[model samples]
Target: MAEQEHVEESRKDVLIVACGGSGRRVFAESEDILEAPVVFINSNDSSTIPLVPSGMEGCHGDPELASAIAFENVGAIREAFQGYKAVVVFSIFGGGTGTGMVPVILRCARDCGCKTISVIGIPLSFESARRKLAQGALGKVSEASDRMYVLDEDSVVRMCPDARVNSTFRMISHSIIFTVKCIADLLSGPFFSTFFDKVYTFAYVSEMNPVKAVEKAITASGDDPAGGIVVAVSSDLGEAESGAIYDKVAEMTGMVPDIVRRNDREDTKMVVFFSVWGA
Candidate 1:
């Protein structure tokens, strides 16, 4: 195994880790949109991201072998996660490295006393064997991380049937990035600390009326908010639009919503976040 000369410590409050082939590709494609530091781990020696210093070669889609390799590098992995307030793991869970490494990586983050979130993508239904493998891995990954967001590849493709294959995956990557950004913003606020264990969900709406955006976001979340809600609107949104959105959410959920105004955005995009009791 080849080793990196030194592991540079992360300076950001939040750290993002991309695991496996799909994970690495997503990060490479969307890194420009992300503000936090990102680390990559994979079995491929040719990968641009530094490989873990274990002698083992690629897992060849065997999750057990991937798990063993990750366990071997626990000390190094833990070191990477240290000093960050939160760690977000990104992976596509059908293959070997992601299915195996993600759970271990999340555990390392938790051990380092960092809040853990995982954004995982499952394979399409036609890939029956890979889908089965992903399903098996989900339980372990969910238990290991504090917050889990699952993206169904089949559903995503179905939603945009006309999109080219690569474009569809790019859309999925954007969704993951959006989730990460929203979580990072929410984590900085006082509200997140109060509901750390709640079932948090998110939705983003662009090119829609502010009030309608809120409605669509809530409806898309598929979870009824029993507690707090956070609505983040683009900078260009008017005070009137913001106020109307707030009233709409409050009327719908009977909970006063927290509004976060973004100064960086020029377009009329809104991201809605809320928490509910976990089942």
Candidate 2:
């Protein structure tokens, strides 16, 4: 781990991986914003997009089956993830495939010397059975990950109050894509080693003004950024705009922010990543 941290330019690429049906659905819609090579691993060979090995089977919502399938195909997982400096696993936890296979995948990525990060969504409060399963599976997932960013499914409703359920889920998936882009850009830079092992919560804001976007995300997360914070913005911003973002973040967190630049197209999108204690 120590040797992997200090290298300057070698570990630059990030592989964006989507696990299971829910994750693949989101990935299919948000490909344009992903900004990296994207792939999937599923229990069943059902997706239109080619699976990593073409013959991997589904787990039928059984976590034990999922884990066994992942273990049996460890070679394929390692081969698919090889040569990337970092691997970002995307899944909606609580389902059989996600809860069962994600930790195993993370461990494979780490074993192959890639920094492992999981961007996962938890079930809504009303999903009592799934929620309980998600909580139980979280510990294994957390242990295998270098950094994990959580998205609460309930927050999707609050984020888009009146939209139809499908539209709201699409919006939330876009937000998740934006966050993935931000983290991928950050890993390409020199600051990744600073926060290697911790839990974080993320938010996406697409306001034209950088300050307002950052402020809104901070307020929404309700997490103190003092421990550490990353504010990622579009690479197209002007010097003044970038400076204003830096100033706003420093004012809020009382610490210099790790700013990452990306090609966020027309909208000035900002994704804020902040650490959470004991989560």
Candidate 3:
């Protein structure tokens, strides 16, 4: 156990890769908050038109042959991933680039000795065709990824019923960003702990009252929540409010959660990320 922990600690480099148009847009918007190296994979120059920050990188491929290219250039992709402890991939399913490249990237990351986690956004049920494609991609992702989080678009719609199209996408982006940040905090923050053997499930709630956020997070974790839950709260709330959030998480999970707080936001709204491990 000590040797395994030492191995994990030694490979601390983390790389976040975003694929497809929606994924790239999310990466571009949330890059400031991510505070890590980012690689954006796209199928064409049009998708790369957006202004990317200095430290970020981009990989472009032909739309019709992106998956093929990924498979053929496995060596190059693995090289890019070398020395990283883990690679977290953010992609929206149903799209050509993201759906096709996700599995390939997962395989490449593993080959490079990096543990892989995929954060995928599934299409809403209303979009039947897209949902079908997403379902197909899910199988490949399951086989390749060491761990996976499927963020249902229907959940985003339910959370923001009155939100416009752009607002809905923004909410999805917030979920992805918060989830990634929470995991990073556990792995490298000042309050680091070895409780995260594997993240079995996760939930995200944004712009909600602290109590309601905890309730929603628990509900999102499903009916039976038995695990060491890690709750990370990002808000500008006071110490008392933060305490309330922590207490709620502990009460709901029936376990003393590993809690982390961030007060950098100017908004009154809070973003809560919950990651549950164990059976």
Residue runs of model 2 more than 4 Å from their true location after superposition: 1-12, 29-32, 47-57, 194-197, 222-226, 242-256, 263-267
Q: Write candidate 2's Cα lDDT for 132-165 as tens digits.
A: 8887888888899888988776655655468897
> How many clashing residue pairs are found in candidate 3?
0
Q: Give the TM-score of candidate 2.
A: 0.82
Candidate No. with top TM-score: 2
The collision pairs in model 1 are: none
Preferred candidate (lDDT higher): 1 or 3: 1
Ranking by TM-score: 2, 1, 3
Name the candidate that leads on lDDT: 2
- Candidate 1 lDDT over 157-243, as tens digits, reads 644568897887777777667766655555554535544543554555564678877886776555577557777766567788878
Location of the lowest summed lDDT over 10 successive residues in candidate 1: 1-10
TM-score of each model, in listed order: 0.76, 0.82, 0.72
Give Cα-based local distance difference scores for all models. 0.72, 0.76, 0.66
> Residue pairs in steric clash, candidate 3?
none
Q: Candidate 1: list runs displaced more than 4 Å.
A: 1-11, 46-57, 124-129, 153-164, 194-196, 218-230, 247-263, 274-279
Give candidate 3 misplaced runs (Cα > 4 Å): 1-12, 46-65, 189-201, 219-228, 234-279
